[model samples]
Target: MILYTPLAETDIFPVSEADLQKRHCVSHNGKQLYVEEMEDGQFQLLQVLSTDPNDFMNTDYIPGTILR
Candidate 1:
């Protein structure tokens, strides 16, 4: 799985396991990280660390960030 800094936009790109040959951009070390798949299969971005789900209820706006 890959990781990325979440955007504030409502339209989110969906990463699936069937599209492993795709490319994506992530932010790491104050730079934009580009990742490409080597295999022709599906993929998904799994968050290694995330905010508590309950925190969503208390905030009017949530800023998404990469955990690692």
Candidate 2:
């Protein structure tokens, strides 16, 4: 099992326009999340995680990382 911890405040650390164009997500938890690109040229985060019953805001998801 993997765990992710995300930011608490959107005011300080926000996803920039450039990052929105470059988020290539890897599959997780036997399911793949699909994030779409909006007509305004910004990538929308997958609501799948945000709508989780435990964490409704999905603010606590940071992909696991391997440190070697």
Candidate 3:
């Protein structure tokens, strides 16, 4: 696993590099998909996404300092 600092010149995400720039963390239960805010003010899904990619960013972040 690659660990990137928030201040890193590169952007890091919970999922694969392809799925990095995502804002919603999607979790599926059968036919239902649950997507939550990524990097919410409270880091809501950080804990969840950190462990599983099932609910991960759907968008990509630009390489630099990302506030979220």
Q: Which candidate number maximizes lDDT?
A: 2
Q: Candidate 3 local accuracy as lDDT?
A: 0.36
Task: Sort all candidates by TM-score, best to worst.
Answer: 2, 1, 3
Better of 1 and 2 by TM-score: 2
Candidate that scores best on TM-score? 2
| Candidate 1 TM-score to native | 0.22
Off by over 4 Å in 3: 1-49, 60-65
Count of clashing residue pairs in every prediction: 5, 0, 5
Candidates in order: C-alpha RMSD to true structure: 12.9, 10.8, 12.4
lDDT of 1: 0.40
List TM-scores for all candidates, in order: 0.22, 0.27, 0.16
Tell me which of candidates 1 and 3 scores higher on TM-score. 1
In model 3, state the lDDT of residue 7.
60
- Pairs that collide, model 1: 17-42, 17-43, 18-42, 19-42, 20-41
Give every collision pair in model 3: 21-59, 21-60, 21-61, 22-58, 22-59
For candidate 2, write residues 1-68 as lDDT tens digits: 54445754335468888756655443445334445455565444454443446544344333332211
**On a 0 to 1 TM-score scale, where does candidate 2 land against the true structure?**
0.27
The better-scoring model by lDDT among 1 and 3 is 1
